[model samples]
Target: MKILLANPRGFCAGVNMAIQCLEECVRMFGDNIHVYHEIVHNKYVVERFTKLGVRFVDEVSDVPEGAILVYSAHGVSPAIRQQARDRKLQTIDATCPLVTKVHMEAIRYARQGYNIVLIGHEGHDEVVGTMGEAPESITLVDTPEDVEKLSFAPDAKLAYLTQTTLSVEEAGRLIAKLKERYPQIESPPKEDICYATTNRQHAVAQLTERADVVLVLGSQNSSNSQRLKEIAKSLGRPAYLIDGAGEIQEDWFTEDNNVLITAGASAPEVVVQEVVNYLKTTFNAELEEVVTREEHVTFPLPKELRQLQLSN
Candidate 1:
């Protein structure tokens, strides 16, 4: 058996920054930190932090007044920030810059009086936050069918943006549909899908071609991770999204199969190595890493965290 491991997989720059922000908070505050959401969507990461006394809460009210709160890599709505401020919580914004870019575009389009269409999965944290930027102007749509139902006049001033973690092919299809329906609809000044998402998806798509079965290491709620699994399945390969090595089922693989393993943007490399170790021990698999792209992107820690570091 052979293993085709994917390069450019696992924690992206934004995830790294967010995780670091949380780690610094824990170290400085001694584990009494409150996170607005899972710092990133990986279950292992969240569970590890929980073990260290970090608390994850969905609402601002859940956090004690004047406590330290870190926003997740997925940005939050302005209302959530206001609530934090109202309670005097010392907040660190760990929102990925790419996600923040979409929020800015939503605000800009709304201020310009353009009816905005946001291409993203409804109810996703990132999508919800971007829509909240200009809820009165932005309408969320994820499918061609959703586009078909839109009743905007063809000549009405219109603009579109996308979630930073969308599948490239899926976003392209949706954008095409929007353009087909509204010839004059404007796109974001730049593509809203983050570079990390595009690189990971492209790498997986290439590896899936030669793989008989594909394994994606990511949490179920991770949007980019889900997209990687879907991309493989779309190519007629058997793909499973697993959180770690323990989720692997022997029945899914055969001695003759070539397996491809990749991790999501928020997944840890340690989880990938665990899966690789399991495969090597069980199947004596020969590992080959397929590199589709090289990434060197880095994001700085959130300003609030940096200031806290400086004061300390």
Candidate 2:
């Protein structure tokens, strides 16, 4: 069996920055760190951090007063920031700059009196936070069918933004529907989907064609990871999303079938390698890497961590 690995599979810039922030916080301030969310939506990553004494909380109110808190890479609303401040928590923002950009766009459009339509899953951390920016002004839509269900007037000034992790093709179709309904709908100054998502999806789209089955290494809660599996399944390939190699099943593979593997932005490469090793040792699979694009993007550590390092 031949195994095709997707390049740029794991650990995108935002995930790198977020993990770095948590590591730095641990190194600088000790193990009593609190994060607002799962950090980057990978179970393995979260468990590793949990073992290191990081606390993940669903609400700012759960954090003890004056505790050191790190925001997740998914970003948070201004209200959450204010809540943290109100508690006098020492805050380190690990929000991906790209996610922050979408929040900024949402806020800007809201201020300009344009009804904002954010395209993303309704309960997703990123979508929830972005919508919190202007709940009164922002309307959330998950699909093109949702766009048709919207009850906006013909002359309403409108703008649209998207979750950074959405499928590029899916977002395009939804945007097309929006345009058809509201001819003057404003778009973000730039594409809202981040580069990492686009590149990974492109790799899967190209590699899935040649494989009988595909495996995506990421947690079930990860939006980007789930999208990778969905993309492969949409292409008529059997795809599985697993947290790591341990989740792989013998029945999912057959001696005659070639497999494709990719990982989500938050997944570690070590996990991907584990899956590869299993295939090699078990099936004697020949390995090939499929690279659709090269990524050189890197995000800086959060400001507080930078200042602490400078002081030390």
Candidate 3:
């Protein structure tokens, strides 16, 4: 057996920044810090933090009036922000800059009096926050079929934006359909999908070509992770999305199978290593690291944290 590991698979810059923000909060303010949601979607990461006494709340009211609250990388609606302020909570915004760009575009197009067609899965944290920017103007579409369901006239003043974590190919299909139906529709100045998501998907697509079976390391709810699995499965390869080593099944592979292993952007390197080690010990697999892209991206800590650091 052989193992093909993807290089740009786990912990993108945004996830790194968010995790650091939470860790810094824990160190500075102690374990009593409250996060608006799971800092990232990975189950292991949230469980680990929960053990450290960090509280992940679904509602701002769950937090104490004066407690420190950290926004997840997935961002939040303005109403959520207002609620935090109303509670007198000290807040740190850890939203990914890429996601923020989409929010900005939504605001811009809405102010310009355009009906916005947002390309993203409905109810996703990122999508919810983005639509909240201009709820009256924005309509969420998950697929080309959703585009057909749109009731806007062809000549309607329209603009489009996307959720940052969507599958590139899926988003492309929706955009093409939107254009077919509304030839005059405008697009954002930049693409909404983040670099990390595109690069990781590209890497997995490349690996799947040479791999007989693919193993994607990510939680069930991770959008980018699910996209990786879908891409592999779309190419007619057997793919599995697992959280860690224990979830791997012996029946899924044989000595002749070439396995491609990758993790989602929110997944940790330690979990990837654990999976790699398990495969090696079980199949005596020859491991090969495949690099599809080089990433040097780094996001600075939240301003509040930086200011606190300077003061200390």
Lowest summed lDDT window (length 10), candidate 3: 139-148
lDDT of 3 by residue, 1-312 (tens): 999999899999999999999998989988989999889999999999999999999999999999999999999999999999999999999999888889899999999999999998888899999989999999989977789999997689999998888899999999999998999999998898999999999999888989999999999999999999999999999999999998988999998889999999999999999989998899999999999999999999989889989998
Off by over 4 Å in 3: none
| lDDT of residue 194 for candidate 3 | 93
Which residue pairs in candidate 2 collide?
none
RMSD of each candidate relative to the true structure:
0.7, 0.9, 0.7
What is the Å distance of residue 2 in model 1 from its true position?
A: 0.7
Candidate 1 runs further than 4 Å off: none
TM per candidate comes to 0.99, 0.98, 0.99
Q: Encode model 1's per-residue lDDT on 1-312: one tens digit a residue.
A: 899999999999999999998888899999889998788999999999999999999989999999988999999999999999999998999999998988888998999999999999989999988888889999889999999999998799999999999999999999999998899999987899999999999998888989999999999999999999999999999999999999999999998789999999999999999999999999899999988899999999999888889999
Who is ahead in TM-score, 1 or 2? 1
Clashes of each: 0, 0, 0
Residue 117 of candidate 1: its Cα lDDT?
94
- In model 2, the runs with Cα more than 4 Å from the true position are none
